[model samples]
Target: MSTTEQAVLFSCAQETQVGILSLPAEQAQVGVVIAVGGPQYRAGSHRQFVLLARRLATAGYAVLRFDYRGMGDSSGSARDFLDASPDIAAAINTLHEHAPEIRSTVIWGLCDAASAALLYLQDTKDTRVTGLCLLNPWVRSETSLARTQVKHYYIQRVMQRTFWTKLLSGQVAWGALKGLARNIRLSKAASPSRGAGDLPFQQRMANAWTDFDGRILLLLSGNDYTAKEFLEYADADTAWSKALKQARLERHDLANADHTFSNRLAQTTVENLTLDWLATTSNAIK
Candidate 1:
């Protein structure tokens, strides 16, 4: 299907946010809102977001890729993903306003943006958002990072011949061994206290995941450390492990893909997975 693209300005508090709306010749009832990750804008790394939006639009879904507060062409003070719920809520409202025919929506996000999507749902409980496409969500913490490094990095390195060669030749530094030891201790440390104090963002995310009745598509990139960390965290945390097994959730892994799915083949695979998942969600909605 042929698609049309245009720039849109929307309100998020006192600031005006910018977005690119991609509409197919025949719009579908379920629209897509692309929640951009921080330290990056709507164009994404190597224009991946732009390509994804266009492909989704070409497949007859109305797509919107936008800059939240303080990112891209938008004007505002900078904030982290934990504080992005308001911005995402605004974007979803804007999408609905632009496409009145849209009855429900799906949030498509990557990295911290994916975390923001769950946060948005947690904060607003917006019923219009019927699905989520999350790619390598951000659940980073000291323990999770240490555990992931020990498992994915240190363990893998120990199995390599080059590591043994360097150790036998006395080329391996003492600091490297100390760092490994520190990581080991951190990896085995107890989970943070959840008594009375404010709950951690990871717990909040898990709560949202468990409470949400909408369909979810989780995509992980095998070559990315961030993706590995997310898997490690999910498997380690009891709440997160249970949430991952929810009936409405689906998961896919791209073995050769990087954090952003920068290459054409990887990008195409992502688009295909998204399209297929969206179709299922749309059918269920009907």
Candidate 2:
């Protein structure tokens, strides 16, 4: 199907925000809302979102990629990723209003934005969110970060012959090793508090994952440490493991891709995977 793309202006908490909406020629009941990560606008790094939106639209799905307040063309005081719920909600409302056929919505997000989407779902329990496509979800906490480093980085380094050669030959800097040790210790000691509100962001993410009943598609980049850390986090936390092990989750790893899947081959791989998943999911639900 042919696609039509248009610029959109919407209000969130009295602040005007900008978005680009891509509408399919053939009407569809499902729409995708792309919630971008911090330090990125809707266009995405390397115009990924623009390309993805067009591709999805051409495949008969409506897509909306928008700027959160304080990012891109949107207006508001600078806010962190955790504070983007209002902006996301506003974008969804705009997409639905413009295309009333969008009865089912899938939120597609990357990195921190993926985490933010989970947070929003936990808070609102919005039924419109029928699915989530999360790529390299950011579940960063000091403890999880530390554990990931120790297991993936440090352990790998310890086994490398080149690392030992440098260390024993005095070619490695002592200060660097000391800093690593200090960080490892600090991260190990920094566990999340047990209290509800005081809980760490990772716990909050896990809570959202548990509460959300929507279908989920998780894409992991093999070269991205952040994605690896999420896997490690699942192993470290019993709650995370319990929820994930028994959930209706679909996961895929693009071994050749980096964090953003910048290369042409990797980028195409992501797009195809996403389109295929959406097609299959839509069929299943219908």
Candidate 3:
């Protein structure tokens, strides 16, 4: 299908946010909003978001790739993913307005932006959002990071001949061993109590996941430590483990892909997976 692109401006927390809207030739009842991760913009790493939006548009899905609050062309002080709920909500509302036929929407996010998508659901139970496409979700806590490093890095290193060669030649720095020890200690330490005004972001994400009635597409990159951390965190946490086992969740692991699905083949796979999952989501609405 042919598609047209348009620049859009929306309001969020009294700030002007910028977005590029990709509209299919035909009217689409299901739209997709790309919630960009930080230290980046709508174009994404290696133009991933740009290509994704176009691919979805060609597949007859309207896509809106936008910069929330302080990122990209949006106006505001820099805010992390933890504070992106309002921005995501505003983008959804704007997309609905622009494409009035849209009855349901999916939020597509990578890295920390995936966490922000869950946080948005937690903060506002917006019925408009019917699906989520999360790529390598961020769950980087001290313990999670330590566990991921120990499991994916140190364990694999010990199994490699190169590691033994380095050790035998005294090429392995003492700091490397000390760092491993520190991570081990941190990994074994008990988590601190929360006496909060607000729940931790990870807990909030788990809450959203447990309560969400919609479908979820979880894409994990095997070569990314962030992806490993998310897996470790989910496996270790009761809330996350239970939530992940839900029937609504669909997961895929791209074994050779990096965090951003940077290569052409991996990017194409991501886009195809999204298109397929979106087809199911749109069908569910009908």
Q: lDDT score, residue 62, model 3? A: 86
Write out the backbone clash pairs for model 1: none
> Model 3 over residues 40-91: C-alpha lDDT tens digits?
8889999999999998999998899999778789999888998888888889
lDDT-best of 2 and 3: 3
How many angstroms is residue 277 displaced in model 3 relative to the true structure, after the best TM-score fit? 0.6
- Sort by TM-score, best first: 1, 3, 2
Task: Give the poorly placed runs of model 3, Cα more than 4 Å off.
Answer: 191-197
- Candidate 1 per-residue lDDT over residues 149-193, each given as its tens digit: 999999889799998889878999767778999999999986665
Clashing pairs in 3: none
Q: Relative to the unseen true structure, what is the C-alpha lDDT of residue 220 in candidate 3, on a scale of 0 to 100?
A: 95
Pitting candidate 1 against candidate 2, the one with the higher TM-score is: 1
Residue 64's lDDT in candidate 1: 91
Please give, for residues 117-228, the per-residue lDDT of candidate 2 as tens digits.
Answer: 9888876788999889999999887777888888778877878899878988999877757867966895567456667566676777788888888788889999999898
**How does candidate 1 score on lDDT?**
0.91
